[model samples]
Structure formats: C-alpha cells, structure tokens
Target: MKAPGNVIGFPRRSFGRASAGRSEPADATDEMSDRLLAVAEHGDRAAFAVLFRHFGPRVRAYLLRAGGDAGRVDDLLQETFAAVWRKAGQYDSRRATAAAWIFAIARNRSIDAFRRERRPEFDRQDPAFQPDPQPDGEETLATRERAESVRAALAALSEEQREVLRLSFYDGESYAAIAIRLGIPVGTVKSRARLAFRRLRAVLGGRREELR
Candidate 1:
C-alpha cells in the first residue's frame, strides 16, 4: 500500500529518501483507524501494510525530532509498530484517533530506549553481585546516612516539583505522559524536573563535601 503524500517527507539523510509530491485524503485519519481495527479483528495483512506505509515515515520523523539517533530511530520505529500491532485491540476511536494511539506507542518506545541507555550495567564478576553479605556496623551506618540524606533532599522540594520528579524518575514516566496525567504543559513538567534536580544536586553535593 502506497503512503499518501501527507505521510511522506522526512529528512532525506535520516532514512532513505521518500517520494515527493503526494497528499492525503480528507478522511485519512478515519481511514487509518478502520485499517487498524481490521488488522486487530481479522489479522488483515493488507490493512496492516497500508497502516505501515502511512505512519512509518511520520513516526521516524517524530523520533528524530525527539533526539533519537539514526540507528535508534530505526529500531524504535519497528518496536513502535510491533506494539501497535499487538495493542490494536486496545485502541479506542472514541477516546483517541489512530495517529494519536500510534504516536503514543512511539513516544513510549523512545522513553524505554532512553532509560535503558541511562541504566548502569551490572558486572557478574563484582563481589557486590554475589550472594548478600550482612553489613558491618560502618556499612550499615553509612547506608542509613545516605538514605536519610536523600529523604531530606526530597522533602525540601516544593510539592509540584517533588511530584514531577517522582513521576519522572521513580515512576519512569515520560514528560509528555506526566503532563497529560498532571493536566499541565510538557514544558512545565520539564521545568519542574530541572529545578528539582538542581536543588537535589546542590544539597547532596554539600553533604558529600562535609563528609570528605
């Protein structure tokens, strides 16, 4: 299935160049939704193909705009579509348009990728990875002190800033998702997170310096 002109036109260098000079129909959004439903209900290959052609480039563009590298963008595009295929039954046209549903999947895939990159790799050879050993007096006291410090830092934040930080880091929610949940703008979520982190770093850094 050929994508409509409206669906094409991501940067030429990002993925392969798309065909120029095309346009989508007025009923394109509804049409896409119907195709997704067909795939969900009947496992329709043709309908799935059409949906892919239509949304693939747009999803690629969105991922790139979200700061994904070329390699990561391609992988995320595949992951996002795979999720769409698997979750098509959950799509509700009354609640969200097909494009909205597909893009939300893409956004979540991007967030998962980012979190994976940020996570520290565990080493099998490290003693810490071995069966747990009871902590001695110094170790136990140090652990308690660190936990107390973190708790104090968190307590110092304003309610809004603390909530944003909790949703972002602890709950692993994307800024866009948090914004939707909080009924605030995405920019506000980002701003609150930034302020919260800055405050945390200042407080934690001071504590470390005193310990040294």
Candidate 2:
C-alpha cells in the first residue's frame, strides 16, 4: 500500500522512470511496485489495472481514516488512480516512498473532491445550524486577507514557479511531476518551488504584528 503524501498527475500508467535504482531490500511489494511503475508510465492499461488492484485498497483505506464519507469514497478512489496515469513519469522512488507517494496522491484527491463540492446548504433553522452567533467576525476577515496575500504573492511569481506551486499545492504534484511537465531537472523544480513558498511567506510577513 502507498504510505502517505502522493501527488498523481494523470490516470493509471505503465510504470515510468524515476527510481531507476535505489538501495533497498528486495521484497514482493517492492518488486511489484517496480514493474507497476514501469508499465504504468507507458500508459499500459493492463499494468494500470494491476496497480489499481494492488494499491487502490490502500488509497481507499487512507481516505476512510481521514473521515471520508462511505458514499463518496469509491468515486474518490477512481480519481486517485486517474491521477497516477498522468504522472507515472514523476515517481522517483529514491526521493519518496512509493507507498507514501501514492498515499499523498490519494489524500490530495480526496481533499480536492471535498473542496469541489464544499458549500453550506443554507436554510433557516437548518439541522446543521450551530448556536454560535457572530461567528463571522474581523478575525475571520483578517485570516482570509492573509490567505489572499499569499495567493497574490503566488500570482507575482514567474510563470513556471506559479504553475509548479499550483500543481504542487492545488493539484498535489510532486517535484518529479513538476520537472517532467516543465522540462526542468527535479533539483531545479524543488529549488524554484521552495523559493516561491519562501517569497510568499515573506510577502505575507508579520510576527503576528502587521498582517497578523
């Protein structure tokens, strides 16, 4: 099973390149993982199917642990595999656990699913209503403003930086996928992304002083 923190780009894949060779003990799952990654990278449907059978349960389990609604978990499970299809080339086993990468991807997919459907069903005296009045206040406004500042800072970045940031943050792309899509080295991709994040942090600066 994928461990945690995956960032799949497309649907199922023929295992692609990244972790060409890492010093790790040989095991059944690892061996299967290697094959799954290679064939999946090439868009082999059969390979993708194998991957799904092996890893899909793990992804589903992860979602369940995260408090996923049983009704929608199945749908999210399919979406996570789809992401794997488009991003097989980005799996660098050396830099990340195959399991962890898969986990992260599934987690991101679940969160994205929620965000896409997130909206309060408003109705007077609704069953979901809470007793807390004046919940929306200046504090909430300030927090939102800080988020906007971060978004603005991201917008100010170089096109490549912004793209990577969005894929990494919103789309749950790993450094490897960002490199493949951007035609840059993984190191360069990570460095650029780091710089972007740092810049955003500075732009929204405050020791809980100004922006805070």
Against the hidden reference, what TM-scores do the models get? 0.45, 0.40
**Candidate 2: how large is its RMSD?**
19.4
**Model 1, residue 110: C-alpha shift (Å):** 0.5
For residues 1-212, write the lDDT of model 1, one tens digit per residue. 54465233322321221122125333355566667777777566667778899899998988786777999899999999998888788775544567767877787777778765654445445787763344344433332244346678999899999999877764567899999999999999999999999999787554344444
Each prediction's Cα RMSD?
A: 18.8, 19.4
- The candidate 1 region of ten consecutive residues with least summed lDDT is 13-22
Error of 2 at 212 (Å): 28
Give me the displacement of residue 173 in model 2, in angstroms.
Answer: 22
Give the poorly placed runs of model 2, Cα more than 4 Å off: 1-27, 115-212
Candidate 1 colliding pairs: 5-22, 5-23
Top lDDT model: 1
